[model samples]
Target: MKNLFFIPFLFLVTIASAQVQTGKASFYADKFDGHPTASGEKYRHNKLTGAHKSLPFGTKVKVTNLANNESVEVIINDRGPYVDGRIIDVSKSAAEKLGFINQGLADVKLEVVDPGDGKASDPGRPIEHVAVDENEFYEFEISRLKPKGYGIQIGTYQELVNLMRLADNLKSSYKKDVTVQVKVINGIKYYGLILGKFPSRPKAEQFREELKKKFPDAFIVEFNRL
Candidate 1:
């Protein structure tokens, strides 16, 4: 809930996975139910289908709510979410399962579980495909750190005001030590917010579940004692 400096959900997951995309996601409107989609199939509200800017019509993608870590596998059957900063548009049912139907927009990570035929879903709608690197972002790799215990990274921001604002709020609300980690890229400075010093990975992980209620994208980090 800050400025869209391009960086999205603040969750870190370790796994053997596909190219993960971090961005904002939205659900389809109820009015579009039963309407014809780009793939020539009718859009059903209950179907676990979604629209991507360029993935083939039948590609299966796993969309994860970075905030809450909820995930849903949906088949790509349309092309859209034409709005800037948004990565995908899922069916209403998928959105409900992902637990973001009420918020309408959720910060998410997308993994292409299965690549479908590399053919256009809609000839009428030209593919405005953007490579993963083309995504706008403010987060950057930090200089090596020698933190003691583990930490939880909540979010990163281009605006120090936003970063500090969140840090102050989180510190007071959670009663934890807050740290602002800085990194510079192309002369632009970015800040990463971290909550500190959980004695062990398991301790940090146990606390992570509680923080997810508010910062769904929060993730564990190493060398956080610094």
Candidate 2:
């Protein structure tokens, strides 16, 4: 039960946990502008918004570039940096403020100044990962139960605690099953948050359209050996 502490930590994650991290940070490409973010808001290059691997969305974080000591505050609105060593992704403007737009990536330290208000997706003090207990968190195993179907992949996360927390929250709020599918990408362990089981691509696509209001990046994935 390694990370089972998350079971009780759910109610207080916003209050009890104050995480800090140090890693590489990159900014979104110009193409990402106007696309729907994980928080259901349009991605704007000028906005002070960013994406994190596992901080609650809507939380504010202070990003400091170790090179020049330049810093900027951004609101967490998405998830990512599946890139091997990156920890956070910011908007073009944020990168400019941090003085790293030309560098593409910068060594940075992150500190969470505030937690989310139940929105989309961190901070830094050097915390490596969120805690999650396997005995209690792996309950949403949709692969073996409905292995052959179309599932909507809303998000993919590194820490199981982040995946578990979102899955539990969705199941309770939407009153629908949110499946957890474990996979390994580029030597990294990740858990994907999937919603609904549709029999066909058209059906799944339709559902995805409706879900887009909440999850703009939602995409359909076929569940095979998954």
Candidate 3:
């Protein structure tokens, strides 16, 4: 019987080492504007994504609050919960699902369900690859995009034209891409102007510094993409 147990124990150990790992973590919410996230995607508060220091982008994680045993599946999209000793930065929705919104933070357990390509996606870092032109009009930039990322928004306005103008100005100054989008809420339209699908906060903030020269009131927000 002892020998039989030994075989099972070894098997269990091997499986444990081979599969993904889990650890205790503390989550954070989006706090500032113009902060880039790990996976070159913009950060969005309403997203179901999260930031982990080491997990590869596009990896899925199941986070459970040990205190309450509340669990939620968070796709690893960004690079951090940068604070020391913290393991992840979860979206507000994930925190809410984990029943920790009122407390603002919680001690949770995070298990990597997928390892991805072993790189946590950050928005600031640009990965270059071959661009394939499928046709005269379509050019496909073929690179392994880690599928999830975070970005910071510089401003949101009630007028689409104003947002457009701001986005244009930012693009001219930085010589980079700027995007504008319109959102409808309760029949009212609002426009959002954002910059840098950067992978890291430092990179986003660097761009934010330039935008400040023209738009003093610009603030930061998060955007996420699947």
What tens digits encode model 3's per-residue C-alpha lDDT throughout 1-226?
Answer: 1110000000111122112334445555457323556556676767778876544456577888888998999877765555655667788778888888777667776765543322334424643331211111211122222212334455555533223333443444455544444556677655555555666667767767866644455555444431
Q: What C-alpha lDDT values do all the predictions have? A: 0.69, 0.69, 0.52
Off by over 4 Å in 3: 1-35, 117-226
Given candidate 1, what's the lDDT at residue 60? 77
TM-score versus the correct structure, for each prediction: 0.47, 0.49, 0.42
Off by over 4 Å in 1: 1-18, 119-226
The residue ranges of model 2 lying beyond 4 angstroms of the native Cα positions read: 1-18, 121-226
Best by TM-score: 2
Candidate 3 C-alpha error for residue 65, in Å: 0.5
Supply the global lDDT for candidate 1.
0.69
lDDT at residue 14 of model 2 (Cα atoms): 33
TM-score (C-alpha) between model 3 and the true structure: 0.42
User: What is candidate 2's lDDT per residue for 100-125, written digit by digit as tens?
Assistant: 98899999998876543333423222
lDDT of 2 at 78: 78
- Give the Cα error of residue 94 in candidate 1, in Å: 0.2
Each prediction's RMSD over C-alphas, in Å, is: 14.8, 12.2, 22.5
